[model samples]
Target: MPIVSLPVIWIIFIDIIAWTFFHLFISAICMRLPLAFFLKDRLLFQVFSWEKSGELWQRLFRVKTWKGFLIDGTIFLKKGYSKKGLHGTRLNDLKIFAAETKRAELTHWLSILPAPLFFLWNPLWAGWVMILYAFLFNLPIIIVQRYNRGRIAAITA
Candidate 1:
C-alpha cells in the first residue's frame, strides 16, 4: 500500500543508504545532547529488579558470546565514548561509561523511529522488511548498552 513505487533493486539500495543515513543522523544529533540527559536511569533504560544486573541478557541472548563481535558505532562517528571496551576501572570512568551507554541506547532507539518512512515509497512487504531491518540493525546495540549499563550499576551499587 505504498504511495509510490520503485524496483526491488532500487528499494534495496535505498534501504541500505537510508538506514545508514538514519543511523549517522541520529547519532550526530544525540552526541550534541547534554550529557546530563543521559546520566539518569529513566524510561527504557531503567534496569528492573528481575534483570539481575544484566545477567538476564546473558541468559536470554548469550550476549557475551556475541557482543564482542558487534561493530562499535564510535568507529563510524569518530567522536563519542567508545563502547568497544571499558576504558578505565576508576569509579568516575565507570560512571561516565554507564552514562554513555544510556546515550548510545537512546541513539539506536531513535534510529529505529524512521523505519515507517520507508513505507512511503516501498511495497507493503518491503516496508515490513524495512521495519525488520531497523530493529535488526539497532536492537543488539541497544541490548548491549542496557546490559553494560546494568553491569555498571552492579559495580556502582
Candidate 2:
C-alpha cells in the first residue's frame, strides 16, 4: 500500500505534540490547588476518585494515612488517628496517596489531546486517527483500574 503524504504525517505529529503540551500546561495550572479540594469539589468521589479508592484500600491494608496527594507535599498524619477514624499515619496511606496522585497526573496529561479537533474537520481519516489515539492512551488506565479492583477484591476476600 502507498504511504501517507508527508504533509499529512506532519500534521498528525503536530497534533500529537500540541495535544501533549496543552495537557501538561493545564495540569500544571490545576495542580496548584490541594488535590483533595479538587477531589471533593469536582465530585470526583462519584467517579471513584483515585484518592478515595486509595484511602479505602489503605484502610483495608491497615496502612498509615497521610494527607496531600503528591510525594513532594506535606505529610500530616503523624499522631493519633484523626477523629473520624479514617485518619492514621502509615506508609500504606502514603503509598496510596502517591499512587492516586500519579493517576490524576497521568489523566491530566492525557487530556491534552484535542478531541474536538477531529470534529472540526469532516475527513473520515481524521476521526479514525483521533479515536485510535484516544483508545491507545486510555487502555492502560482501564487495565490498571481493573487490576486494582481485582486486587482489592482479593484482599478483602
Candidate 3:
C-alpha cells in the first residue's frame, strides 16, 4: 500500500524528477570512484560460462543491430570517460575499454536498486510500473556493457 496518495499527474512528475536524480547521482558516484576499483573483473562483471564470452547476447539480442542507437551517457557528465567507441587500437586502450564497461555496468545496476522506493508513494500497479521502468531503462545498457567486456576479454586472451 502507498504510504502517501498522489494524483497520477503528480506521480508522473515526481517519477521523472526522481529518475533524473537517481541517474545523475549514481553516475556521479561511480565516476568519482577510483579507476582501480574497476580494473579487475569483479564477480558481478564476470562473463559466466553460459554467456559463451558474450555470443549469447549476440544470438539472443542481436546487440550489434541496435546498440549503436543507444546514447553514450558520458556525454552528459563533465569528467566522465567516453564509452561511445574504442579509444584506440592498442592493448592498453582495449584494457581501459573493458574496465570502463565494468564501471558502466555497475552504474546501471545501482540505478535499478532504488525502484522499490517508488512504492512508498505509488499504488500497487504504479509501483510495479516503476520497477518495469527501471529494468527497461537500464537493462539494455547493462547487457551491452557485459557483451563488450566479454568480447574484450576474448580479444585480450
Candidate 4:
C-alpha cells in the first residue's frame, strides 16, 4: 500500500476550521462573561507588545491604511468593530477597543493549537504546515488590535 500524502493546502484548510472553531467558541464565552482570563496573562500578551517606537518588529506588520484592507478586521472583529468609527474623544470607545483587543488576542492563543493536534493525524509535514498557516493567519489581526489599542489608549489617557 502506497502512503498517500496530504497537501499543505489541506492543512491550511483545517487550520481555517480549527481557527474559526476556537475563534467562535472563545468569542462566545467572552460575550457571556468578563472572565478576561488568558491562559498566561503576562507571557502571552506582553511578548507580543512589540514596542512603543516599534522599529524592531512591529514595522513588519501593515500600517493603519494598509491593514484596513487585509481583512478589514476593524469591521469584522466581533466586539468593538462598530466602535472604530466613534470619536476618540469618547472614553468608552477606548474601553471597547480594549475589550476587542483582548478578544483578538484570545484568537491568537487559539491559533497556537491544531498544530499539536494535527500531529495525531499527520506527525510530519502537515503538522508543521498547519502551525505556519495558523501564525500567518492570526498574527496580523493581533498586531492590528495591539497597534490600534495603543493609539486609543493614548487618546483616552
Candidates sorted by lDDT, best first: 3, 1, 4, 2
**Every candidate's CA RMSD:** 1.2, 10.8, 1.0, 5.0
Higher-scoring candidate on lDDT, 3 or 4: 3
Off by over 4 Å in 2: 1-6, 38-43, 47-113, 119-122, 142-157
Q: Write the per-residue lDDT of candidate 4 for residues 1-157, one digit (tens) a residue.
A: 1133467577567656776786566555545545345322444454333556333334665456566555534344455344344455567645665666666666566656655666654547666776787788777776766676566545655
lDDT pick, better of 1 and 2: 1
Q: Where is model 1 poorest over a 10-residue stretch in terms of lDDT?
A: 36-45
Error of 1 at 82 (Å): 0.5
Candidates sorted on TM-score, descending: 3, 1, 4, 2
lDDT of 1 by residue, 74-146 (tens): 8898888888888899998898899899999889899989999999889988889889988998999888888
Give lDDT tens digits, candidate 2, residues 14-59. Answer: 6668666665554454455454553332323232544354455455
What is residue 122's positional error in candidate 2, in angstroms? 8.0
In model 3, which residue pairs have backbone atoms overlapping below 3 Å?
Answer: none
Candidate 3 has its poorest 10 consecutive residues by lDDT at 75-84
Clashes of 3: 0
lDDT of 3: 0.91
Residue 45 of model 1, lDDT score: 77
Regions of candidate 4 where Cα sits further than 4 Å from its true position: 1-19, 35-50, 53-58, 72-84
